[model samples]
Target: MKSKKVKESVTIMTQIVLPNDTNPLGNLFGGQLLAWMDLASSVASKRHSEGIVVTASVNNVSFTTPIALGSVVTLEAKITRAFNTSMEVFVDVWVEDRSGKNRTKVNTAIYIFAAVDENGKKRQVPELIPETDEEKVRFEGAMRRREMSLILAGKLKPKQATQLRALFE
Candidate 1:
């Protein structure tokens, strides 16, 4: 398979927060935001894999600010790294001010997806080449995140996580 650039897998989505999408406190519901993030990340992973992809895990979702009702929310997702059959996606959520002149980052999340064939069998994905400085940093951090995820899932021993261990050493 041919390698693809990070820019090729970028996905952006925008939504207007409505009353039903928010909580009684008038802020967007966390679950609603999570759903949007999942969709955005899935699209990004599919673009990178060029095939059906299933979400394997969601990691490090940080909700820094509350999005109020009537806010214009935007989600941008990109493939940070691609492994044999899996890819890591990063999603950023931004909320625009009432005047639409300013935007603030409200949330961020990381998602892992596994490419699959028609029969639901795992399939290989193309390598990802990160060009920009931010993309390069995210690409490098993906290994450590993956290792940590594996350890948390009990699929890898703590000592076997070379990338994570390197952080302390």
Candidate 2:
């Protein structure tokens, strides 16, 4: 498979938080933000793999700040790493204040997507080549994160996580 640059799969989506998208507290619902993030990340994964991709897992999404209604929420997603048939995508969420003309980062989420062929079987994807400093950082972090995810899911033993072991030892 041909190698792909991380920038080639970047996706950005912006949406205004409407009343229906918010909770009774006048802030955007957590689930709403998660859905938008998932959509953006999936687009990035598909662009990288050039095929259908499904969400394999979604890491924790800690909302640092509440996004008020009417705030313009922007989600930026990029492929961080590609492993076999799965790709790790990092999504950053920012809330923009129209009146202040300022943007504040609300949260960051990690989503793992599995590329599948037309028959719904997982397929190998192109390797991700990080060109930027930020991309390089995320690319290196993805391996450790994936190891943690596998261990948590009971698919991998803690001792098998060589990258993670090196971090602690």
Name the best candidate (by TM-score): 1
Q: Please identify model 1 stretches exceeding 4 Å from their true place.
A: 166-169
Clashing pairs in 2: none
> Model 2: residues >4 Å from true position, as ranges?
166-169
lDDT of 2 by residue, 37-156 (tens): 999999999999999999999997798798999999899999999999999999998888868589888899999999999999999999999998999999999998999888788888
Task: For candidate 1, give the lDDT of residue 25.
Answer: 93
lDDT of 2 at 30: 90
Q: Which window of ten consecutive residues has the lowest lDDT sum in model 2?
A: 160-169
Model 1 lDDT-worst window of ten: 160-169
Model 2 lDDT on a 0 to 1 scale = 0.92
Model 1 lDDT per residue over 137-158, tens place: 9999999999998888888887
